[model samples]
Target chain A: MSNGYVFLSIAAMAVTTYLIRMLPMAIFRKKIENRWIKSFLYYVPYVVLSAMTFPAIFTSTGSVLGAASGCAVAIMLAYFDKGLLTVAIGAAAMAFIVQFAGM
Target chain B: MNLKEVKEGIKVGIPIALGYFAVSVAFGVSSVQSGVPFWGATLISLTNLTSAGQKAGVDVMAAGGSIFLIVLTTLIINMRYFLMGVSMSQKVEEKMPMWKRLLIAFGITDEIYAMSMSRSTHLTGSYMAGLIIPPIFGWTGGTLVGSVATGFMPSILAEAMGIALYGMFIAVIVPPSRRNGNVLLGVISAVILSVAFTYAPVLQIFSEWSVIIITVLVSAFMATFFPVKEGADNE
Candidate 1:
C-alpha cells in the first residue's frame, strides 16, 4: 500500500461518497409530486437498516445463540429508549462475558 | 449557529458520538491490521463519516481490489444515505448557506439524520453544531485509541467488541421493524435474499448487491403501495 496510492484512493472515495449524498438532495429540492415514490423513500431506512443488521447478527458465529444474546439485550435497552452507546456496550459486554464463560 | 444552540446540538450529539467512538475504533484497528497507516485511518474516520463505506474501502484496499470494485462496494452499501440526505435537506432552512449545507451534510448518519429531521421548523446552525460535534469527537477519539493500541487487544476481543456495532445497528432496526408490518416484511424478505446469496449457487452473483437493491426496491415498492399510516413525517 503506497502512501500516495492509499491517500488518493481514500480521497477519491470520500469525494464520491459526499457527492452521492449531496446529489439527491440537490436534484429533489422541491417536494416530490409522486406519493408512491415518497412512500418508498419513507420506508427505505427501515429496510436498509434491517438488511444491514440482520446478516451481521446471524453470521457472526454461525449460531444465533451468541447473536441472540446480544440482540436480546440490545432490543431491551432500545425499548427503554437507552442511548446507542449504552445499548451497544451493554450487549457487547454480555456477549463478551458469555463467550468468555464458554471458553 | 448561536452559542447556546450549538451547545444544545452537541448535547444531543453526545450519545451518537459515543456510539461512533466504538465503531471507529474497530475501523482504526482494522485499517492498521490491513497495513493502512495511522494517518490514513484517522483521516478516513474524520472525512468519511460513514461506517460501511470506510470499512469496505479498507477491506478493498487490503485485498488490492480495483478502484472500480472499491467504489462500487461503497456506493452500493451507502446508497441508503442518499435517501437520508434528501429527507434531511428538507428539514434545513431554505435560506441556509451553501457552505453550511455542505458542511452539515457530511455529518448525516442514520441516527443524526433521524433526530435532526424529526425536529420541528426551529432548526438553527447551533442546532446543527450540537448534532455534529459529539460524533466527531467520538469517532476521532476512537481512531486515535485504536491507532495507539494497535494489536494490543486480542482478535477474539476485537471480534467481540464488534458486537457493539451490531448492537447499535439492532438499536436502529428494531423500532421500525416492530412497528410497520411492511417494514417487517421487507426485512424478512431481504434476510432470505441475503442467506440465499451466501448459500445458494448462481444466486451469489448478486449477493453484495442484494442488500442495497433489495431493500431499496422492496421498501420503496411497499411504501408506494402501502404507506405507513402514522409516518414520522405526518407526525
Candidate 2:
C-alpha cells in the first residue's frame, strides 16, 4: 500500500476510536439511569473480548494442536486467577512446546 | 494534578503496562506480516491505543479495503469504548474539566478503563494521566521493537507468540465469568455464536460483521434476561 493510503486509514481509525471513547466521557455527567442500558454497557466488554478471542485464537499459531494447547493452558491458568503476564506467557510457552514437539 | 495521586496511578499501571508490552509486540509482528510497514504498524499502535480495533483495522487495510471500511470496522469493533466512556463519565471526579477529560479519554483501553473503575475513589485527572502514560510507552515501544525485529526473529517463535493476546483476553474475562453467572452466560453465548459464524456456511457471509452483531445480540440478551443488579455496575 502507498504511504498515503496507510496514513489516511490510520487517521480515520484513530479519529473514529477517539470519538467513541471521548464523546461520552466529555458529554455525560449524570448517571445513566436505565437498567437495560447500564447492564448492556457492563457486559459489552466481556462479550466483545470473548467473541474476538475464540475461533481467531485457534488459527493464531498456524497449528491447531499448538493453538489448542496454548488456549487450554491459558484458560487453565486464567481460571486459577493468574495474572495477565503469567497467563499470557504460559500460553505462549505451551504453544511453543507443542509446536516444537510436532505433536 | 495531585502528585501523590499520579504516583499511585503509576504504581498501579506498571503491571498493566508490562502486559500491554507483551501483547503489542505480537500485534506489531502480525501487522507487519499482514503487509503494514514496521513504521506504519507502530504508528497505528501510537495513534490507536486499542488492541482488537487496531487489529481489525489493519486487517482491512492490508486487504486493500477502503478507508471507509477501515473506519466502519474499527467503529464497530470499538463500540464498547462508548460504553466504557459512559461509565467513566459518571465515575470521574465531579470537578474534572472538559479538556482534561478529553485528553484522558484518548488513553482509555480496556485495561485502563477496568483499572480506573476498580479504584476505591472517584477517578482524578492526575491519576488517570499517570496510569495511562506508562502503557503508552509500553505499547508503542513494544511495537517498535517487534516490528523492527521481525526480520531477524525465527518464524517459530514469532508464530508461537501469536497466542499471547488471546491469553490476555482469556485472563480478562475468565476470572470474572467464574464470579458472575451472567458473565459466564455472556461469554459462552459469544463463543458459540462466533464459532457458528466462522463455520456455518450460511452464516459465513456475516463473518465480516460477526464481532459487532454477536456482541450486540449477546450483550443485549444478557442485559435483558440477567440484568446486573443495581449498584453492582463494576463487573
Interface RMSD (Å), every candidate? 3.5, 2.0
- The candidate scoring highest on DockQ is 2
RMSD of 1: 3.6
- Give me candidate 1's TM-score against the actual structure: 0.80
lDDT of 1 by residue, B94-138 (tens): 778777777777777777887887677656767998888789889
* Model 1 misplaced regions, further than 4 Å: A1-9, A24-28, A58-68, A75-82, B29-38, B52-66, B83-94, B118-121, B147-150, B220-235
Question: How would you encode candidate 2's per-residue C-alpha lDDT over B1-235 as one tens digit per residue?
Answer: 6999999999988888887898899888878877899999999999998887888787678768778778888887787788788878888898888999899889888789889988999999889988999999999989889888878898888888878878888998899999988899999999999999999999988786777788889989999999989887563
User: Can you give the DockQ of every candidate in the order shown?
Assistant: 0.48, 0.71
Docking quality (DockQ) of candidate 1: 0.48
Task: For model 1, state the Cα shift of residue A64 in Å.
Answer: 7.7
